[model samples]
Target: MSIGNVSAVLVHGAWADGSSWSKVVERLKAHGINAVAAPLPLTSLHDDVAALNRTLERIEGPVVLAGHAYAGAVIGSTRADSVKALVYVAALAPAEGETVGDVFYRGEAHPLAPKLSPDQHGLIWLPEEAFAAAFAQNATAQELTVLGAVQRPISVSCIGEPVERPLWTDRPSWFLSAEQDRMISPDTQHFMAQRMNARVHSHQVDHTPIVTAPDVVTDVIVEAVQAVSTR
Candidate 1:
């Protein structure tokens, strides 16, 4: 399959939506790579994976599945024959016996990281200020405003749920580790990526590189597209 023949389907993490990949989608299209950002309910892992699989169903075969933050488990569990590659962008990939929360709270929390707690509604929201302080520390003031305004809260149940065997275990995979990330520890990212033996790309970006560093994020996805095509 050629670059134009394969598509990249992006899955946004918790507290985010499909629009999070807007810049990367634009860049992929410019390179003649079809792109789609799967809308996740963030209600539960099953719901998110089902939603991603639906988006995967729409795209043709030879697709590269990309995820950020919490969506990593979502993308990994939605493994299907249509997918030829996996891309983890500062994302998590919990083992079969592990829950999202298990790997999420694995390392010591960053001092600048905000404390997370679910509201009465059972949704965990990123405090508005945390957008600039932790989530996207490198984002501009304007970008921070947009990120905070359009934020979506994730269900507490989402992380509590355990994951099945992830596709990264066997598929061609790429991982982009955010070195300056405060959300998910950079150590955790490196550990997961290395455990999967994925081709790794480390950067001095924050948690949400798809927004703050689209070029870095897009380049890796582009590389994944070309890589699977050769295989």
Candidate 2:
């Protein structure tokens, strides 16, 4: 099962866009790896999967599709055959017929997630205060400010929608668990990793590992690329 050369498509989580992977992307490029961040719509499962699939359709070679947080569900549902491996970066990594909301509710609540209230349009967005404390605890004041300013609203519907496919079961998988994550518990991440039989890596960082430890995150992704390419 040795794939020759493959591109890596990085997907951002809730409240984030492709820029979240800027530092990691630079590191990957420095290693002569072909990588790009797929800017997820984060509006709904259907739209997000469509966006990811479109990105996959454009890639010219086998791909290692990496997803964080909500995008994990996106990748699981939209398992493009072009994806040779799936990488979870402090991500949800739900199974088929499961939703991101189901994963969170099944596990104990993280201490920092603000009490959420959905809008009429069914979108769930963290309050501004929760942004700094829960989502970007490891980030500096300036980074937190930038995150708050650019945060995208996610539809609540996306959380409850079941993943139509389970990519991890079909492809080689990797998981990066954030030991200090306050958004999603490390225990829950471990459970998912074990269930998927993923090669696991741990970092004493926050939920946004790409922001706090971009180099290490890039290394983990590069390992997945190598594993897939040399398979």
Candidate 3:
């Protein structure tokens, strides 16, 4: 199975946009694979999924959808037939009838994890300090600066809604568990991966490994792409 015709749609998580997958996009391209960073509005779960589907619609063939952090729930909610496999990168995977918050808070929080609250606009912004302290502690200082500058606050409604049966149950799935993630506990990642029966690839990375450890992130995504291609 030649993967030359396949595409990889990389989705970003809350508090970030499409550019978050820049490193992974470049890495995937180097492997002779086509990858696109799907921009998510961070407005609400519905809006994010719509945005992701829109991107998926533009691609010409089968897709290996990869989502990071909060985008995990977004990818899982998608019902697109073109999406053949799912790759969860330190992401949250809420089951049918479960809200994103339910899975995100499944276990104890990391001491360094920021205390988040919605503002008057009902949007939750990751504190600037959290970019380095927790979100991506392993990222370079320059990377942290860019991450903070381009962050998009997520609306409270995004995490409150329950998802339908996730696509993970219908397709082959892979998970990259960020072992040292400060935002999402490693235990929670493992729990979700096991629940979905996804192939787990655990690594000692931070919450935002797409920026801090692009290689690790791309490795899992490429693995999913290959699996989809062979199928």
Candidate 4:
């Protein structure tokens, strides 16, 4: 439990690659904090968890493993004990035996998720309109254009796959709720935060808080680092 010097590993969510954390990485580095963004496969939970675990394996010292959106479930199951804490940024943070799909179905459906249907490859992607409105609601015209072009298709199977274990149960956790999130409601985020007994922070931003409010996100992450060090 005593991980000497702590670092951070950032895991991004669906439709996004690791570049989503570019500003966050820069800010953390400016403070001399070691951080790396883990690029998830996003194709399947199994593959994504493997990628996360591999990244965790390479880090030296204690780590605060942070995840956004879908990567929440990924880090939960990756079994990286070097991860002394977790920070969920508008992320799923599901309990053991619960799927991300189950969480969504139980909550009121968002207006912008799009009517999804899987192809022969079993992938599900949000329509361009929904992506623009829900995922990047706070983005400028240029950022929204870039997001549209590079978005990756997520595997439908990943949504319903239950996490075997939830890291939050064993680790100190922080949750940043995007109060203006269009894809996942603010109420649903509150429910998850309460369920996990997390130290919760709120922002008047979209689902992609890392982009819309990097400084606020960085503040919460730095607080988590301080908490772990104190403990």
lDDT of 2 by residue, 49-115 (tens): 9999998899888888889887888877775778888899989977778888888666777878778
lDDT, model 1: 0.92
Q: Cα RMSD to native, each candidate?
A: 0.8, 1.7, 0.7, 2.0
Structural similarity to truth (TM-score) of each candidate = 0.98, 0.95, 0.98, 0.94
lDDT of 4 by residue, 1-231 (tens): 232367989998888888889889988877667889998877778899998989888988788888888888887887877888889899897788889887666677677756777778988777778756788788888777777787788898789788887888989899999998877778888999898899999889899988878998888888888778777
C-alpha positional error of residue 22 in candidate 3 after TM-score superposition, expressed in Å: 0.6
Distance from true location, Cα of 9 in model 3, Å: 0.2
Please state the error at residue 204 of candidate 1 in Å.
Answer: 0.6
Question: What are the per-residue Cα lDDT tens digits for candidate 1 across 105-192?
Answer: 9999999999999999999999998998999999999888889988999999899998888888879899999999999999999999
Model 4: per-residue Cα lDDT at residue 106: 62
TM-score of candidate 4 to 2 decimals: 0.94
Off by over 4 Å in 3: none
Q: Count the backbone clashes (under 3 Å) in each candidate.
A: 0, 2, 0, 0
TM-score, prediction 1: 0.98
- Superposed Cα deviation of residue 128, candidate 2 (Å): 1.3
